[model samples]
Target chain A: MSDNISSSRLTDIDGWGRSESLRSIARRSFQFFYDNYFRVEWEGLEKIPDDGGALLVSNHAGAIPMDAPIIMHGVEQHLGRPVYGLADHFFRQIPVVGTMWSRLGGVPAHPDNAYRLLRDEHQLALVFPEGTKGTSKVFTQRYRLRRFGRGGFVEIAMKAGVPVIPIAVVGSEETMPILFKINSLAKATGLPYFPITANWLMFGPILGTAISLPAKFKLRVLDPVHFNVPPDQDRYSKSRIMDESESIRLTIQENLYDMLAHRGNPWLG
Target chain B: MGRRVLLTGLGTFWGGKVAQSLEKHPDVDVIVGMDVTEPIVELERTEYVRADETYSILSRIVDATQVDTIVHTFLVVDSTQMKTKRLHEINVIGTMNLLAAAGCAGTPVRRVVVKSSGMVYGCTGRDPLWFLEETPRTDPPETTIEDSLVSAEGYLRDFAQDNPHVSVTLLRFSNVLGNDISTPFTETLSRGIAPSIFGFDPQLQFIDEDDVVSAIEFATSANVPGIYNVAGDGLIPWSEVAKICGASNLPLPPFGTEAAASILRKMGLVKFPPEILQLLRFGRGIDNSRFKDLGFSYKYSSLGAVERFAKTKRLSKAIGIPRSPYTYDKDVESFFHHSPSVVRSTQSDSTSDTF
Candidate 1:
């Protein structure tokens, strides 16, 4: 029954499940958040290469983690290249959210996905090394980077033969601060952690859970870290992966502190 | 000597298709096909051997035929068609017996190609965007069909390890959509409204049935050993797939999806088995580059496969398909094989292999 049909594509969706039409619409709508709501400011944007693959490592924060979309929108608008945002698999557990996420270029942070996006396709990819631990932290732990996931991101960049460009983000932690967490509710709902965020308390249940505080966002791109070792090996030295991962984390952490130190107010950059 | 090949499940659609394709190869001197029932399609030179569902007589047939290549296309991937125990017997025990026959001391079989489904990966929200051949499923198999396939693949891995001389190639194919094949996806799309989970538009990958057959043939002929993933290039949203099929979706409530599916099943509108249900929620994509790297080029992409099916479906609906559904005749087949009155021609017949 399989007959040949030439030129059958109907949508602009790519193999990564990213649709340029949807991405453009999302970017246009999100432009407000970048310009007015959070008034995002950028530094060292040129550090991100104009072409070829590079892993954009950043400090993840906020209960909803707005850094991902912001970073994706900024790069695509300025550099004219699509950035594949790699996030936790948990986002996929949701129905509408997961579908919209994928169409807007959200990919599960699987090593295979990273390797394919970076090494094979030679496209830009953005990843959060700290994963859930970074986004789920409480207000007290704001700006303090969490431990990277055993340096898996480092190993992936090394394997893909791509340089790791660390980006430090400020004010995301204050966007929707985690006041406290309810472990029982989290366990019941199968969530990593359920937090009673500041947004919820300040704006009632609907707005609090859905919206982030208008905290001015400032971003800085660090130097791209390139591993001297050869790429595409069956295995690499574990010690080297850990060392590279920790150094990258420290670099982002220190830069975050520097960016925060320069800012006098959270809401007013 | 020309290549002698043995095919499993000649009565099934895949088995019959593979046999017809194999008959076209001039180098293939002998084609022996075994199945529980008579072959579905008529064959010119291929010999059909009737065997039980488990293929109890596989060893004797293997020894007698001394076929060099074995194409195991009998695995029942669809769970809705049979009971769990029967599926286990056909998938697990059947594979065990076939492997035993192929691995026996001084066995003639040196190449084996097992056509497996991507259900072995077990769709989950945690799965990677594209599953490489070696990538493990995020969670273990929850459904009976997945469990059976996993166990059968385990045996193949062990057999390959024990019998290093034999080249074992396992092709895990993603969801299939063809003009004649009626999978869960097709069944739903053909109905009044395809059932989809509310608010979920999972991205899926599909391959044309032609690609599936050619892949099996390529595996039998090529020396490339080990496992490889097979599917058309790219992923398409389930919504886009429905649009291509010109079918509207009946979004089942996200909560209590199972209960809704059961009610629909009782209505006999469509079959939403566990695998299909999970796939509807979180569709799957397998990395086909490994197979493509070996010079395999697919005739259709994911969208192309769905588009082809939609075109054929619309045509059939408009003119009431002219297909007569071929039925095998033993007398005519035997007469063609043994009758001295019959004439053999150099050119292949055009009537056969036309789905």
Candidate 2:
């Protein structure tokens, strides 16, 4: 097939040729304990294509949104192409962080923007189906995924005919074990919920750290499952594709749960 | 024949439950109900003393009834009415008066159980561990109701120390949930709007009224001296509690000095006072494992106490008392209709100015 877009356009859209300063900062931050402290293990890096349109679906945990940066760093290193992220609207309202996020190709998860990013831009979109509810779930309810909320991610992938890649990140839960949920406080702050982790309040100003213990994070990017729809068939026929998509979701969830159960050392081997 | 136990405040919310539980004790010959109001006719008490918990008036009833065990459960907990003077009068001085009366009573006064709050562990600059019976009051910020509690506890501790003959058992309880009195926290929640929670995460512990009464009786019988942490069996996050109570839809603004000022300004019959708001924003969990180790089991533990409390007629009446027709969007209209614009503006100004 003939190349639809020029390499320059692809590079620009992917945020591959962005500011060297930002890239350097990100690289240094991840490399702070790259060899000494945290030894990250990636299981399925081959599943992600070097350059193309795809969807990366992952299980979310961690109080400070730690999983996102790790996934971004890993993808940039392995695929040699920048991955675009779909973030919540609130993040865009921040001052300096918002501008940096935009520069790094973090698009708001508005449906129109997401569709445009996949179809016209041909950039890989990362979406968490369970949303905030999944990440903020109490320790008692961890790993037990909430309802996928009618599978909108599956529909988005099928409509664009992009392959769906299920990614799982273990050790995020162990980093900050949610002791209990502070309902009154969470409701007061307008957040979905805030986990009452051990020493969260007392150690905040003293340490300037939101989470404790740098648990070894194990990322497993499952093999992509492609949805083949005939050219003449309408988008309405996408419901047939959900059964397969759900199987992938469930399979990844089970594998992640099992891995978390058996995995002894937080410092990944 | 054994003498009747004159349990004052039994007719009131917390005391009434305590009186009812004490009735099950075989050693007790009778339970004499006394409060500001008349006792429930259905309650099978030996006698009902319709007297105020004030020292002079209650002293006569104690003399007449020949009450051996005087369980003083009378204390007003209205945060709105707790001015500095009122806090000293009711919580500190009022408790002092009762203790003094019990000490000098004609009848053999064996024990005095005073219900204190865990709010004394004010929000700032303290270690998070089990608050033992002997934990000294650290210098808390002046803006908390916990300050009042600290003063109250100090007075009680001194009184207990002086009158060693009177077995003073102080139960330092967390939020007490039951049907009788409407708590400011749950009442705000029942407004059906998203209640503003403070900075996202603060540990919460609640004690059921059943447990409260059980704890009082345990204190009365065992004559356990010193402070004891009395709370429900399990802990739940406030967010989950709100959701379970169907009050999670309401938005909670960030609680700071400004929020406290606004709450103080909105100090109506329904609103919480500044002191209470301060307590809500920074309160910690209470450890009641000591009570459990003493072979005590709570009847309605956890948020189940809230559910039980909601089932009462008092709650139904309060909830049915028709709020204004204005939606949360029309907060200005709601405030203007409910309170003076000057006060509302001042509240808004204070909140903005402070934080």
How much does each candidate deviate at the interface, measured as C-alpha RMSD after superposition?
1.4, 21.4
Supply DockQ values for each candidate: 0.70, 0.02
Please report the candidate that would top DockQ against the real structure: 1
Off by over 4 Å in 2: A1-269, B1-3, B40-42, B50-53, B81-84, B105-107, B125-130, B141-148, B249-270, B306-355
- Give per-residue CA lDDT, model 2, range B1-355, as digits (tens): 6536767665566666676566556567757766656543224333555564455576665676667776767655556544666555556666666666666735477667777777676543232323455555455646435555676677778877877777777787777765545677656656543343444323356776667877888887785766788887545445445554556443345525455456545754236555455443433556677777877778766656655554443446656654323222234434443554434333223223221
Model 1 per-residue lDDT tens digits across residues A1-269 = 44556546778888877899999999999998799998999999999999999999999998888898889999999999999999888877787888788889988888888999999999999999888899899999999999988888888888899999999999889999999999999999999889999999999889898888999989998999999778899888999999999999999999988888889889998
Report the lDDT tens digits of candidate 2 across residue range A13-127. Answer: 1221134356657767776654345467789798898776788888777565566767877787777676767767555444345446655656556544455556545778887
* Residue B276, model 2: Cα distance from true site in angstroms: 3.9
